[model samples]
Target: MTTAPVRSRWEEQRSFDELGRPLRDVTFCVVDLETTGGSVGDGDRITEIGAVKVRGGEVIGEFQTLVNPDTAIPAFIAVLTGITNGMVADAPPISSALPAFLEFARGSVLVAHNAGFDVGFLRHFAREQDLPWPDFEVVDTVKLARRVVTRDEAPNHKLSSLARVFRSGTTPNHRALADARATVDVLHGLMERLGSLGVHTLEELQTYSSKVAAAQRRKRHLADRLPHAPGVYLFCDDQSRVLYVGTSKDLRKRVRSYFTASETRSRIGEMVRLASSVTGIECATPLEAEVRELRLIAEHKPSYNRRSRFPEKVTFVKLTREPWPRLSLVKRVLDDDADYLGPFSSRSAAESCLAALHETFPIRQCSDKFGRHPSRSACVLAELGRCLSPCDGSVDSSTYAAVVRQLRDALLRHPDDVVELVNAKMAALAEQERFEEAGVHRDRLASFVRAAARTQRLTSLTRCPEVVATRRDDGGRWCVHVIRHGRLAAAGVIPSGVDARSYVEQLRVSAETVVPSIGPIPAATAEESERILRWLELPGIRLVEVDGEWTCPVRGAGRPHPSTATS
Candidate 1:
């Protein structure tokens, strides 16, 4: 009996591995296009296309096709390319030639002398023709030459100059096939020079040719240990303190990019400079990677992580459980029966929502807690008719409770009442030409509705004790997620032929035991739950099992209120 190969938790066989495919293993389709004009936006059309597919310095195949431009070829263009309208009249149209070219060039890095002109025309044509453009890795021979050959070796990095400098066997002319052939030679020549500089892999060559700073490029070794899988990465300083935290589908590619020009953020550059090492935590799925990143960032509070590090600072608008209930902004949610409407991003946002609630309800605004039988004097808000003055028994407990019930309904069950009230108030203000005051009410109403919607959305998921879902990824594997009380407890992937339901149960058994906590986000941070909710809502996600009813309120703040829809 044959034993299966054991896979490490931190390792997975990826099509594109950590070290990247060596230059010899990379297949390149050196392509050239003869166009009617320089700009696709100027209604340019491809007259001819030529491509030479090469691997390990050997030409495997060649593609050459004349395309009918469907218009008159300019006399100057005809003179340049040695092809006339007559020559292409019998040739295939771009609709045929383009697809054939794409099929031939598929799964190979595209190369061209002036890549912008050649690739741009092809991309524009594909888009205009409603063709799905493949994400092809492109290499420009001119760019490679500019990096490899100096001014002493070549005056300019143009195709003709590089062709002469490299002593290419094929001479570049205006024709597509000949120029494509010459670019192939130029590409190989540049690769040879790059190899001397220790750039043997496709990834290294691309980075070395890019505008990435030398200092940053030297730090590429830090990503060598990372696996090419979905996960979180922590950039730690010499003291082992995490300086930054991030996540990506491919850990090696993402972490390696920080040392390239692609990572342009100034703060991130400084963080990368200070980083002494990188620690990768590979996860089973992208969702798990994201959740892990969030948890780690919150735990470490890495200085370079600008967001998701201070979920504790998120504020919630609460309905205090006092004799005279009032809307108050609080940081944490407890198991108390008092209603809540937040996890708002800021105190000001929660306050604005509270203002909107007070505007619509005659609830007490006093910060002081009142006894059931109060002897204290009423506050200024009571005198202004904004409060029911429960402090002085101006409103009885039952009557005040009824108002609070309506407020809670507006916040949790239905926001129609609040929406109508705020809209009417704003409309009245606008009628008096008080546009600024109307705008203020509008902003307040927006804040209130947004918080209500967000809270309802979160609560819908958190209320469920357990949820197991699966979605088929592009790779034909079932990505399973085990969630408990809104937190991602566990995640895994099931092979195409395996029973997803059985795998889901296995994942559930191994999932983190999350205890239900108070508030909308029961086990995870509001941000983490929100991300999970979004993933759950995406099309094609199948619920394997749900322990409780997973639902949102019909008329709750989850739906857009008509009055605040535009706002």
Candidate 2:
């Protein structure tokens, strides 16, 4: 005959151990309390107690008791829990039985179906009887069940219902011990499900289990090898092709989160399942990591990554190179010498920018690819005074060129006049209660402001011959990057207790020639330039070098404060 497995004091005390301990090492007490009535406020009292002590998924001990409540058990509750009043009449009072139950459950994390009900009853009894309540880490099977099992898998998150789904060995019969037994089975099943999602530690299981699906948990192994550092991570499928790319200051934590329910993106679930491995490229700084992520997404065009995937499919609002030079939305930024405003996300946004410009400057709206001469006939825009009639040869070259210069100045240098005009239109429309039209005007102004700010920032960065900035990293080390023309040319780390000047000079000389090529004006895209600018604006970052002037308007559209200008 096999003797019962022994539990050492340390093994039993595993609940108080360091968090993230393996699930198999922690002790759990599955408990259930049968009460005479529905709620404690109604003077209900626990009639029976059932608890099963489990370790490593196997039941090693049990605790069952009956407590005389000093009140008659309600007939319906008596029939429901099948614990008659007579059965508990001769039992020990709660003051005596509560101590015994506490002793049996000590040094274990509590598990129960609808744990709040059981724990609440225990707390009430402990308070009345003047008994101390142990601070037990509780796990609710009901909560775990709702997360791990879907409605189709189980009709509802009830103990009896889940018992049927999991096919618990002991059928629940409204008896405390039997229902508690069923809960033990349910708890084990949920633990098994959680194990697949890399929830090896009790802390991870308790924190993430309710939010993670089984499929997501299954891919937790993919993130196991990632380092906890600032870096870019790539998820790859069986074919070793990149499926998704992302950046994180803590690579391990971020990549691991994708395999949990916390990652609510519909496509991410599929991405996690399809991914077989995760590859990490550590960076000295978060800026370098972000830049690397942008480059990787652009290069791989990963199926799961939505943003920064196809920077080429963006629209640019450009002034035509012809003598007429109407504002045109073009797909590609050619070598032609024309003022370009965009790199906008869509053609509609580019159109909004153009409309905002039109509110101030009367540039042509026609899509004509005109020669040195203009179109023979004036379009409807000319009739509406919307265009300067440049297409109809109504506006001369020098006259149109002056209008083009205004557009350029408003876009790049000073947008105060255009901003004032748009604000007046929005306020006037709002006063007339043409709310929808006002909304359109407001969006146009906002689009112009955002485009103007982005354009100005990008232009400033690209015009600089070279830029060097530094931020303090862990251990007081310095993370440095050398940017040239708004592109991340090179990056390096200056370890603590070392001279940074020599290393900085060396890194700058050997920096890579990564040209900016995404946006129309800059060699880089708006997104890339924005990333560099954001990094430079970080609190500890200091601009160490600048070959060209970088400036912003003191009272222009890009200013942070709202403009109070009139039409």
Candidate 3:
């Protein structure tokens, strides 16, 4: 019989006090298993098992056997382990092989490079045999290899690298028995290097093994299951509260990526903080996903959703922005009677669009002299012929208003019509061989289309002169609640510098001011469900719908806009 190698008394006396620890007696069994393939779910079989048991950090005994597997060995695996289908054909089944191995490992701690994988594969075989497999507490040398070796030098620390790091001499790798013997040497080196600190109680080692093994399984499972279809996902906290909602064109791709270490930073910090479970619903089409995304954002108010809300109710002049700019009413005359062109969230957006009228286009931007004649004389733009010079009394009211109206039409209602008109004229000119003029029209049309699309519309005004208001202080922000016909929705300014009561008063006053008077020179019709806007020069008292969707109608950062930056 080959006797177990005994360590000298000096090995037992050595202690690594530098690292510090509460060292305890432990048994570590370096084990190996030859398998049909590197998978758990696939019906792969284990062909062999070998283990070297160590106590007091010294090799004590060894166990080795070939498992019958009862299935044809895959050719790749047969070559890899040098255990062909014929070799395993007459081998004893796992039912017979497991008992001897369990007797050898009775009080030892199982260990491997990726120890969990080997143990898991064996546990799977145990389940297949319907045999009560003995529980052998375990440890993983793979995790220790990275800790002991310089990271960059051994980034790919597989079994061989770990064995080489410890100078383990055993060879004939991939076979169960030979590798286990190398693991025994590797364990010895690790114990000497770690001294007392490396020795842990069997229970503590089992706990550590379970944690590492579970983490590895979770990662593998997520990679295997993430889907490719476009959809949305909801992340829930441990208690099942909805922590966040996210949408993806490719659902599986998005969910799987969430597990990567790179994704655990900054904004995704929240995902790491609260993700207890992942649940997903697949959308059949991308468009369906978009609409569903919008609805879910509004409904769940996901902490991660980045978009929301329309611009508030306000007047807009869709002026064409340029080196020499054109300004005019894009949709002025839109009061409660019409859907006003915009509550332009940004001034840059409001001025960059063209007017609606087919002809009589000109720069419509003003120098505070708009709605009034120039006190001194025609402005500089008038001198440049960029303006119609109505401010200087150079243009009559009939002509000036006519020009303003034309500007409004060109900017607001018929942007496409003007584009078509311009294109036709350009084509006509081109046919007549006027390339330069056609080019100008083409460029102008492109500018008009780009500008019009960036705009927002004021759809309605809410007059709740008689309804009630509720107040709430959530964390810090002041949320004003308004109940419209038994349904509750939040309103009011999130105030600063002043109290909530004052903010609520300010909200009431603003809402009343924006909607004063019934039919103040109303427009004929509103387009796209928006009411036509005519001036409410007189406040005759008008019935209005619930409003406040567009502009916050309030000032500063506390004001809410749908597309406002994430908090």
Candidate 4:
């Protein structure tokens, strides 16, 4: 017979015997519970119990009992769990079953998966029954599996998970006897892995533990310092060139979390080396801060931003008041003719703004060009009072166009005007002794005020009627602008990797989307295009020389803009 080792509680807790040397000793209980879906409270009781006793990594005894839950099993649980009301009808109550379990598990560590849920039921049971809750140290095999199992390499980590890990394919009975035995099997599997990792010392095993009690105290200190509010945050390098920008509902507390440094791959430490200091921009609400943070990150594309998208490179509602007036997002900038509505930070942002405008001004944003679609009556939005109903013929083209213009001016050019108008109305209401009505206007005005304030505007853009975007423009570099009205909407550069002249279809794919002709102005005539030709004397900017053809110069190298480049 293979003689198994024996263990005492002190060996389980301390690893070393009185000899002061490492002893492979531990006392563990593989425990399982069957409950009335059963209650510890309100007269609910345990339906069954099963457990195995293991010491020094050897199972020496087993225990099992069925307790009357004193009630019907919940229908859903009964169907899935295979444990029915009849099995517990003649069994002992929890009062008797629990004592047997305590005697069997004396002086051993408990092991379970998702341990807290099972433990909580027992804790509540004891509290309700006026019994002192049983206490024992525990090790969650689930958390242990997380550290040892090679995620995809292992099939799973449930009792069945461990079964497969160790090829201990004991058929799953799920009965108290079967589950208790499976748990014993699981503990053995963990011991094998733990032994393989040379985890003989109690101190060593504790180091890798996912102990909740210890982690909670540490988190408490971290939370006390983090401000519970809304704001923007910055991760900066030593020189203060922002590496990443973020906004949160809370300021101080979010920044404070990095110092705990418990896990290597968590939030703060991953980005800490790139951060020398933190900066913040506080906003009154999460909504406003989220919107602004998006816009700022897009415009800056801070090097350390983990998120994969940019702001200014967005789809927007471009309103054009030209040959035939209408609204839609333009994807090109042929020869600037109409004004522009956005370089909105996102397509959703653009759409949401359009929805708001539709409610206020009744503008159309659809692919069907003006007068192109027949049966020119009001669109669906008109019936909802969200639109002016220009398509349905309820409103004429001139009136529709005027409303579109007002919305265009309000969103892109001057948002403050809407705020001013609402504020004026609110003031008049207060003067007329209509205080309640005035309050409504006051709230509406605040929204407009905040919206206007949130958008970080590029100043004095009105002077440049024809907006320009220049990015090397060698067949490799593409300069594009998506415009709104007759004025500049948004402009930027995109470096296409292909050579300038070859594969012209893909090469000419406009980074520029145009809306209503803004008519190209002298300022946008590509002074650099002319200057580069004069200096380099090359035909079309040569971004790359591919297959004997020329491409844009800025393509593929992933170089930063001149402004962001270090000297």
Candidate 5:
């Protein structure tokens, strides 16, 4: 049997379709430096600074300064440049020259024949002298020349060779100012070559000569019409099938990044190449965008989305159904009669919550298949007063069931009892001068409270049968979301300059309906509940309508106003 060839998924696309700022609009600062000796690490110092700032191919500013190297010049260097220790005796120190150079070069792209050498010295001195180093974007003419002019066109990519080839007005004389002027002409010449290739933006010019394939550059038009707003974007293939779904605060910026050279993900590049068009669903707030992203990922199950697709993967803490029920952290919730505390963020959090509960309650610790009559030996925890000793038949089932009820009450009904018990134990420990033990109790109490608060906040959203809310978007528009049974059911935008009252009734009728399960608790996973709760907590969002009771605790674990709530 023959097998089909495996096609590569990584596609290369343009960073953006719309041409960004033109090269003429950008400012370029061509710089050059002369050093006392070789390496700065070997105690070498900068002797002379020269730079020419240009905009639209015209010199806008110039910076030149001679500095005392604070060391004697070598004999060979003095003969080469005709500068000696006596020549620079009246010149200012590099510390004084660097400030003026940096100010002149501010907000401009630094260009040099060999940029690394020049920029490295400046950076090293800036750090040593405790001066603010200008974080300038740099372009190396050497690298750009290598990509633009081949060996046949130019024997070498050196500044002098390029200067002779391009016929730059100045000739190199081993002086900083003359070399910098030559570099400015070279920079403009290279930019002209880049402009012929349709490279306009600074980003495009920087990555223009990259090894990315021509096909990748052609795909730059894919993200052309995407809105620059907070929203979920879908990448659809030629068949109009959704290949990937993503959420971003700025849809255009994020999507455009996939085509740039900086995008390192091979698979994402492949996915983008297969995609023919990109569509964005705008939202009023980031929270709404995130919720929509989660919902779409779950609904579409796109080939590229790997997270939150399996809602069943969420971990839950529940009591086992048996004569001697024990608190257990489980991934799946069964139909068996058992009380649950979460859909926690992780199994470790559920385990931590279980440990906190165990610290206060005398529940069973062993995970044994308990029989009608006890036959197993008692563990060390029973002797230490940790467990009720159900394995040894020391504790009756009825008494254990009553303890289970209290555990359930602490987890679900009211977490205040647990908080009060921990507080009292901590107070007793402190009163007895057992400060170390009291501190341990305090930390465990804090962990328990934090976990409980997160749990209750999420659970409150699930408990609500229906929720309707609205928030203002960046464009002065209102967005409405209708959540049904803890899942995002519908979302619509209300444009600016329109009376909200006129559209609210029609939107409410068109909103999707979800019948809540006729049970004491809402049916939802941790991911779904958290998504809904996060959307509700957005700033300036107002709860317009609610079908069922949805509130945090008044006395215990998940209370919003903990200061006012009594322990």
Candidate 6:
């Protein structure tokens, strides 16, 4: 059996030979319509239709027609359009006129001054006639003029004003045919001006004429080299320093959007302005793209990225490996055989989990390093019956060890004792009408339970030496992932007809080697591990193989605490 060649991590970027339908090869149908009134829904009807189809600066064909409204045309509209009801009384009705006009404009890009008014009427007519409207790409000359011509160049973007400005042979006098002919000249004039700015394709013309900033619109060429596939993209400055990193299901589409008006974020605008180029790494699946984006952001620490740059700064609640074990908040996890319950976002969160553990177990809360033969006095916590008081010799080492064992169980395997103890305290406070204090206990309990749950969820995958999973994506391609100690060791997409199991095994063999580190998330960052766990938990994920235990504790703090649910 011949196996498919393994795809490299970085595929050669596909060249965009033709950005999108070069303008010289495009056929444009410049259309104009005279209506009986302002709105089609207000009983208004089309009075006349005129369109000119042109390609390569030459007129190919023309369509002209007058439609009988079946209703009386208002006197003002008839005067404005110079088409009285008497003129169209013997003409064909819209049902006939619209079909002929649509046939003439078929397979051509539509252009009109104030396209909404003209296209809306046409769309309404099509709907009323139960005719399926062809998805035509429309270009509004009014919007295009706004982007290109300034007030000094043209007092107003009126059809007559622009016709005079562009030196059109025909003048717009509210007549459909003459106005459409005038618009054809104006389109060519605008295209000539845009040609110098590199707007040579139909897509580039559409993007250039949008409400985007000219600086951003000029940079649309940066996306021309990107592929239309799921991947990670980086915006870099002249020095090649990454300005921003992002993931997209379609790299070309997403990168092009940065230059369009839809991207409204101010910092993104600044980033785009400073970016000298765009680099894309095409991935086989969306999951791989997302993971690559996270890893890139962490590696580059791009200035414009607001998250995932400081994974090392995350705090962890550690069960210190000392003569008397106690929970301590630390920044780094070491090779010591002490249990850890976090990867909290803040030190306060780690402290909350530590406080909850101290409240439940009478373990030492002090940070003093104790020798084997310690001779020290207990603090005020001992007097309040809060501490086990091993320092004062009030509690034997064995008895205190038992309490530490239960605390370790709460942090690692079972947290029901912590949950129950905290809930009872909250209930007692609420019964005594001390609701405010109860709220405090409720918050701490919630923090502890959530941290415990997150720790267990990550550890369930991190402890496993290898795990392979697969899921069929919306495109019917199987997305396979090989995870080693909770890190994404390998990922690839298997085509629908191929054997997914065999491909997944091949991926596992070539997977990245990961040496398990010491904490709950041994091989990857907490956020990365969480993302992997979420993908694993998503519906339709089939576990192909597992090298070690891959399960969460049955009675662990993986479930929501009662206090958390209510609060």
Per-residue accuracy of model 1 over 479-542 as CA lDDT, tens digit each: 8888889888888887556675676676777778889988665688888999998899999999
Tell how far residue 281 is off in model 2, in angstroms.
Answer: 1.8
The weakest ten consecutive residues by lDDT in model 2 span: 1-10
Alpha-carbon deviation at 81 in model 4, angstroms: 3.5
lDDT of 4 by residue, 1-567 (tens): 010111222323421222112325667777777665544445555666777777766678888887777778877766655778887788887777676677777777776665674566666656666776557877676777777777685777666666677666354455666676777676677767776754554434544454323332233232332344565777777897777777775565455444322445544444564566667765433433554465467666786675533422544355575534666665443444555544444565555445444435555555555562336666666666765554555666667667756765675445544555555666788899998876655544443333332221221222222333233433343433322222222322333454534333232243234333232211221221222223223344332211122222222112221211112
Output the better candidate (1/5) by TM-score: 1
Model 6, C-alpha of 429: deviation from truth (Å): 4.9
TM-score leader: 1
Rank candidates by TM-score, best first. Answer: 1, 5, 6, 2, 4, 3
**Per-residue lDDT of candidate 2, residues 280-340 (tens digit):** 9877667788888988999999999889998878887777666666677888877667767
Which 10 successive residues of model 1 have the least lDDT summed?
1-10
Cα lDDT listed for each candidate:
0.85, 0.78, 0.52, 0.51, 0.76, 0.85
Off by over 4 Å in 4: 1-23, 38-45, 211-567
Q: Compose the digit string of candidate 6's lDDT tens values, residues 349-398.
A: 88877788889998888888876566788899999988988787788778
Between prediction 1 and prediction 5, the one with superior lDDT is 1
lDDT of 1 at 532: 95
Cα error of candidate 1 at position 531, Å: 3.0
Candidate 4 vs 5: which has more TM-score? 5
What residue pairs are clashing in model 6? Answer: none
Pairs of residues at least 3 apart in sequence or in different chains that clash in candidate 5: 9-270, 10-270, 11-269, 11-270, 14-220
Task: In model 1, state the lDDT of residue 438.
Answer: 88
Model 2's TM-score against the true structure: 0.66
1-567: candidate 3 lDDT, tens digit per residue? 011121222334433321112224566778999888888688777889998877775667888999898888888888778998788788898888886787777766688868878988878767877867777666677665555557665667677766776777886479999988887777666556544433333432333322232242244233234345556777766887656677786665566445422442455656545666777766433333444455565667666545442222334553443222344444344333332334344454444333222233543346453455444466676787767666556766666656655555544444544555666777799999998876665654544454443232222222222232332323343334332211222134344576655655554444322223232111111221121111111133132233433231222122232211212
Q: Residue 321 in model 3: shift from native, Å?
A: 82
